[model samples]
Target: MDLREYSVFDIMGPVMIGPSSSHTAGAARLAKIARQIAGDDVKEVQFILYDSFANTYKGHGTDKALVAGIIGIDPDDERLSHSFELAKEQNISFSFVKSDKDASHPNTVRMVIKNKSGDVIEVLGSSIGGGNVVLKEINGMSVEFTGEYETLITKHIDKPGIIAMVTKVLSEHMINIAFMRVYRQLKGDMAIMVIESDQTIPEDVRIRIEHIDGIEKAIVVDSINKA
Candidate 1:
């Protein structure tokens, strides 16, 4: 193993309320990020659990963790244990269903969330042990990003110069890009750009990026594990 790529926290694990790191802490983080991606007006949520997550969720506290996350509770929050009550109090309905479909990871879940506006979003993610997680898909578009950075997501028309123009705006703001990915379902169609930056992109900068021609939406997810 390349020890250089691992931090002390990777070995020691995160400070969280957990009986199992993958099922509890990681599940919470994954659901929390999914909630963030889906926006705050979420009215209802359905968790389609797969593989190990499906087999052992309730026993391992993954059920509570996932509920806690959808209601904006963090893994380390003391309220994690009572997330179901909190969700009911907040009027956010949720359910968990086990799936027999094959998953890429043992701890995987697909979140189908509906907002009060009736808009729905689907997000797929996995907890890869050690309280670490990765979001793999958004609204059926393939994506890959850990919620460890101040990440920016943009949905826009797939056209020439779009990426360059967006990058130029970030460059002007002196935001260093740690990672960037672009995905489209077909040629000359809608596309999604995922950018993980070393520094937080200011709201003004994000607004400028969104105003660019062909850009539909620019959403930023603040770093969950800020260094």
Candidate 2:
């Protein structure tokens, strides 16, 4: 038999401003990551709630938390309660819709965000439980990643040596990769690379990666699970 040790967070959940960890904390984290993927210049956002989230979002303050996150507020921030007003002041429009997805997790929401540049991103994720969340899909591509670590996400053309080039840049910057995954739909098509690093990824490093051949976009997200 294998044994493992659990941290205080595992039992008590994350420190956050919330009535429920799953509904508030986890929802905030998921929305924040979605905004990071879509860029901070988002002009508008649509949150499509599913199952449990659709049924009880307002009561649990999930709607407020989601709005706060997309606009760069932390879960523990006092301002989380007034996220809607903040969004209005920032000129960021948002709407929420109820959706029923078959075979989907109970606490799932899909975010469709459009930036000022007219680029749109669709992100699907779920707050599993206890303030933990997993990103399941980006655009139309299937992906799996947790925003627990400082993450690097890249959109690029799928080709031989592309992975090596990106890794080489990370190695040069002395960034240690804790985990990495690549997702693509078809051969020689567009691909996404998700890298979880043991250290924070600087914005300059992300820019360096973006300038690499075959790379289209690169984004760095700070660890959301950190205390």
User: Number of backbone collisions per candidate, in order?
Assistant: 0, 0
lDDT of 1 by residue, 19-71 (tens): 99899999999888888788767799999999999999989999999999888
Each prediction's TM-score versus the true structure: 0.95, 0.96
Pairs that collide, model 2: none
lDDT (CA) per prediction: 0.92, 0.91
Residue 223, model 2: Cα distance from true site in angstroms: 0.8
Candidate 2 residue-wise lDDT, 4-45, digit = tens: 688976778556897988999889889999999998887899
Q: Which segments of candidate 2 are over 4 A away from where they belong? A: none
